[model samples]
Target: MAYTISDACVSCGACLDSCPVDAIKEGNPYTIEDTCIDCGSCEDTCPAGAISAG
Candidate 1:
């Protein structure tokens, strides 16, 4: 499964820099693209616990 950033995201930008594939976009809640490698890097870096496998 791929990882997704939820509404709980704080727009902290933590996950943005952690994505190796640059799949995360900045917004109220970051969005992960289909190109995501599902490496869990963003999930591990999210400070708000807003990222999860979907």
Candidate 2:
């Protein structure tokens, strides 16, 4: 499954540059697209703990 950003996201933009597949979109919580490869990079970069496997 792909990783998703939750409501806890602070829009800190931490996960933006971390996505190797470039599947994450800009927003409040941010949006992970289907192109996500589940690399867990964004999950680790998210400071708000908003990212998780969906």
Report the Cα RMSD per candidate: 0.7, 0.9
Candidate 2 lDDT, tens digit per residue, 1-54? 868789998998889899888999998768999899889999998889999987
**Candidate 1 C-alpha error for residue 2, in Å:** 1.6
Best by TM-score: 1
Pairs that collide, model 1: none
Score each candidate by Cα lDDT: 0.89, 0.89
Error of 1 at 53 (Å): 0.6
Quote each prediction's TM-score.
0.93, 0.90
Clashes of each: 0, 0
C-alpha lDDT of residue 31 in model 2 = 95
Superposition-based RMSD of candidate 1 using all C-alpha atoms, in angstroms: 0.7
> Per-residue error at 33 for model 2, in Å?
0.5
Show the lowest summed lDDT stretch of 10 residues, model 1.
25-34
User: Once superposed on the true structure, which residue ranges of model 1 sit more than 4 Å away at CA?
Assistant: none
